[model samples]
Target: MGLRSLQGRSGLVTGAGRGIGREIALGLAAEGMNLALLGRHSATLTETLHACVRHGVKCVALAADVAHPGQVKAAVDSVRRDLGGIDLLVNNAGQVDRAEVPLWEADQAQWWQVVETNLRGPFNLLHSVLPGMVERGSGRVVNLNSGFALRPDGRYTAYATSKAALLRLSDNLAETLRPHGVTILDISPGAVATEMTANMPMFADMVHWGSIPYLVATVVDAARGRLDPLHGRFLHLGRDDLEALLRDAELIRERDARTLRLRPYGDEDPLAAYS
Candidate 1:
């Protein structure tokens, strides 16, 4: 499925210099979505821009850390100035340095840092981009999440908790934006071969079930409204229930009940009961 229908759309992807973010940017470019790519590494960021151009989509590479409020504002403003208002925003920037650290030994400082990046980072981007999107009355927001958000496997406190909050954040944003035609989705990809996972201790433990492109496709699908069933819901990407899950309109509608309440992010335990 070529996403040529997405040709005229424009988007901003965080952490897009390498790994999954890089693949996502390229995938969007292939569909003709112009990109405003953001990352910390200047060299890798430039490489993403070139890759987007190779796919023949307009591209702008912005070097900025997603965790920095000032940098996030500046980068988003620059994207608006350069590529027009973004029609899509991919909150792909995340960190899990302490995933293996025991909760008792977790550094509070490090935990806060990861929380700021994994959760607050997306919140900031969505906050900055949302008003314009709401005023425009249409847009898409894809918040990258992890399966651990729902099924934590110990030693993943910071990562899992942040992502859990992120999933709820996506739901909250979606409900508020829905009446205005802005769709928000939480999509969790299975293990992929990325720098973040490359040499991690648990890397070999999990199945290399898929690739970065699978996650990218979910973003593209959400952008095109093909993923409406998963909007405002936590969608696990690598399940035997993939097809049924995607097609389960009733399941989606049930989720809408929870999404409509406009609950605060991080209160997912209440919603989980409904699930």
Candidate 2:
């Protein structure tokens, strides 16, 4: 789709100071959407704005730690005031505990920091944005989840657990907001080369099998509303397995609904428990 289509649209991108968030912000700006960029590092956010200004879209860089509810609300409010109402919200801020710590041995501060950033950050942003979006009767919410959300490995308790919770939040929020013409999507961009993963011991190996550009393209499509089925579900970028993703989401929804539907029956009909 042509970028001009989004000329008047407004978007807020968290973590726009670097990496995947920066890329998403640039992509949206390229589509002519005015941007509200959020990050803790002022210099990095400013760099992101400069990089995106070429798209001829208005860009405002705001420094705020998204994990803090107060800061999140203040920053989002400012964005709404400065850039007009937000038509789309990209929840991309996240953190991971040091790579070497075992789950049981993880420091309390490190663990909480990861949870606050990866989980609480989005919750705070969503809490702030959804009310306005709901009142407006239309909006798009994109969550930057991780592959770990689905297939968690050991030694990643903080990151994995928070991401898993985020997926649940996304699924519930999608259903809750869909009636208002709001869509919530959780995007797992596979592996990417970013500051988050740069210092990792397995960085090179992860990148060898990761698909960065594919993930970015998928986000672009999502912003343009071209990605179907995956709109209310999780996406594994660069794989192009939309059919599989859709199928899995459907299966999950069906399973959940079935469980709920059967719960009442279980108490009334002993035979129902067998099924």
Candidate 3:
């Protein structure tokens, strides 16, 4: 389980102010990794920072909105200056749509805002963080993906669409960064109970909500390069069998599974990558 020598590795996690981000940050710290925490809430970031500090790992908390490219650049610069360099990047900041309405009936501004946060936020972080990782020839990026990305849903069009786009981005980045020794992974944390989900009416009848410890550990493994064989893949903590995925990575790649891809009409299709 302890596949990494993380005593001096530095990482930055967005949305580290609360929820699963805070938990993952704390888990990383416990594994002896130094961290820079980014979020819009200064107070919550401080609270997380304080907790991580108790683990005796170097930690910094910065208040910044992930949706803004300018803020992301500035925050990443500070992370570089303070942490020496980033070995891991976790794009976890995201927002969900409030209403379960059809796209035609959705609030335009709110719809776009969810896209800005869920998709553009990750893009902003990757834009700012990739240069350094590429230059250094080592880094891992974990995007907080969702089940919505893999399925078509009538409700929360913005959330589903944005997550789907993020998954595609992760796949593209993984291929583009392979030669540079950087890896990008997409993982859904599953139905973890949180303030955000508790408010969503979609789960009103949900009998079971899962824990995030497994998700956090999987991320840690990804950060450690233990899961590099499955890079460019999408994993769901609630649904995926990690051991099987790791063991059958060759089969997974041979079939091009666990990735977002367009289905070809037939073997004669001209645009199909598989063809």
Candidate 4:
């Protein structure tokens, strides 16, 4: 579908107050999609909402902590009441531990906080939105994932574990949701220049940065169902070639590539066999 096909579609984006979330919200708005922006801070969300409105599409801002079920429900309900049922959902709100310490050295509270925000946040939003999408029989979901999900990162245990689990969540849901005409994609935006990355000491002197435009374009394409054949797969904007991937969509589906799975010890491996 062309970008114009997105016009009049309704979407809800978490963490729409700033950074990549803000960019995604504006990009969707540019496609003429109505937006419901959810963020922890009203001030920043208002800024994004105003910018999106300039695109001549309907926009609303709601302050809600994505980790809180009550807040997410209320926020989603308001979006349905105002902009209509959400056709797209972006799980963009995430958090990292304040300190980049190993699991044993990490503060308990801070570690759990990161886990809850990154993992539970998406769970809450999905729980609140999936029923409506299933009832409608058509919807798209994009979960902002990371390389840490595929590779083991001991330094940021909580963040890495949360993201890894989220990728699995996307994969598991895809199998069930596909028959309902819903698509779920786990997209890794990579190491983009964002407030979250800047604050991490590990990336203090990082030179190379991922392209935000590429990431946003990938997201838009996924939202438009351009990559539906590869649904429930992990996509890395920095490393994976989108055009090439699209061309190889059939092979990807046949081989179940780009998904997190247990490496089979041999051809007889039960897990791999089942897959």
Candidate 5:
């Protein structure tokens, strides 16, 4: 498929109040896409809203906790009413573990909060908006995933587990929604400099950081349908060569690469079966 223009399209970006989400919202706005920014922080959402408005695109800031179904429903209704339905949905809102602690030692409330915010938050938003997207027969979804999802990190079990589940959710949704012209992708912005990372002591010694522009460009490409061929696959900003991936889309599909799957003990293992 040819690259599609995003001009005049409508999108909803969760956690658009600050950090990577803010950058993504502004980037989409620069492409002339109308936006509905959803976040818990009113002040930061207002800041992002102004930044998006400066790009001359229709934008609205809605203060809502994505984990709450009622709030998500209200926000989705507002976006549909104001922007004429959503063509893009970015599930960027997430929560990290409050501290580096073992699963057994971590505060139960904090642990569950991370899980609910990162996982259920996306579920809430999707539940509210997916019906409209499916009805329209055209839509895009980008779920911000993490490297932790692929690797086991004992210190942040909740975050790792939630992101891992989210990646699987994207893969499953992609298969279900593909025939409807809706593409779902998982994007991992590895080690980007953000308030969330800065607060994590584990990353204090990290010298190399992912480029925000590169991540934003990846999101923009996904939003414009340039990545439809690789839909349901995982893409890493500042690491993966997107052009090469696009060129080898068929091979990746054939190999079933970049997706989560259960590995069998041996080639003859019956438990290793996959479709």
Candidate 6:
């Protein structure tokens, strides 16, 4: 896993219309990989596809809502037919609630919508896309995760809860994929400035924004096997040092750090092992 070429590989990227997803799509395309761009808006998807094709790689844009099971299934079918096969999947589509409010005051439908897009969207893609990967014996999945998944936030409960569950999904799925030569990982883009971020009251005082180019490069690294050491763990671009983490991979795994888990009171606690 020290080095591998992404040339000739094919991938599917959800929410490829704009922002981080579009950058990632272009990054992969530049590396000579074929791409299938998925999102709800066809016009934006077309724009991304145009940009991706300029990299001189095969590309297609398919419009569909990732949150809907049927739509995702159909889109995946098109990917299989158009791109030949999906070697890597980037689950980048997500939604946020209306405002930073308490759970009781949050709009019920909007809360659930956020959860549906962030959590169920990934579930639908995994379910529809994983079987083929398992059968082939090698694959990679990159779920665009968030820091909120690591802690609780009453102000953004829906986003926090869904991301937390998604992280758990990767934790367990990694074990299942290991024997099959597949890997799943979680990564947070680190408070990147976007329309979504500008609207959030939490980042009003922010000065620096995370680099989308760096995030795209990291995603490419994962596909090229440079980050195979971190297959199941969380990678927070803002907080983690890539070289340090890679060099200390064994120590990190030994301590089971950088993952979501319950902490016990002390080593003497009877439930310490489980925690």
- Misplaced by over 4 Å in model 1 are 1-3, 205-207, 240-242, 255-275
Write candidate 4's Cα lDDT for 74-109 as tens digits.
999999999998999999999998887878999999
Better of 1 and 3 by lDDT: 3
Winning candidate number (lDDT): 4
**Candidate 2 lDDT over residue span 40-122, tens digit each:** 99999999999888889899999999889999999988988888888888999999878766787889998999999999999
The global C-alpha lDDT for each of the candidates, from Candidate 1 onward, is 0.81, 0.80, 0.91, 0.91, 0.91, 0.90
Residue pairs with colliding backbones in model 6 are none
lDDT of each residue in 88-148, candidate 3, tens digit only: 9999998998899999999999999999999999999999999999999999999999999
Colliding pairs, model 5: none
Q: Model 4 reaches what TM-score against the true structure?
A: 0.95
Error in Å for residue 91 of model 4: 0.3
lDDT of 2: 0.80
Report the lDDT tens digits of candidate 1 across residue range 1-275. Answer: 25576888899999998888888888888888889998889899998898789877889999888888888999899999988988999999988855587777888889888899999999889888998899998888888888778766668788888988887777656667778888787777877777787666887777655656778877777877787656577676766355777777676676464232434456566664454
Instruction: List clashing residue pairs in candidate 1.
Output: none
Query: Poorest 10 consecutive residues of model 3 by lDDT?
Result: 1-10
Q: Report clash pairs, candidate 3.
A: none
List residue ranges in candidate 4 displaced over 4 A: 1-5, 267-275
Candidate 2 residue-wise lDDT at 264: 40
Estimate TM-scores for all models: 0.88, 0.87, 0.95, 0.95, 0.96, 0.96
Displacement of the residue 117 alpha carbon in candidate 2, Å: 0.3
lDDT of 4: 0.91
Candidate 5 per-residue lDDT, tens place, 155-175, comes to 999999999999988888877
Q: Could you tell which candidate, 3 or 6, scores higher by TM-score?
A: 6
Q: Residue 136 lDDT in model 3?
A: 93
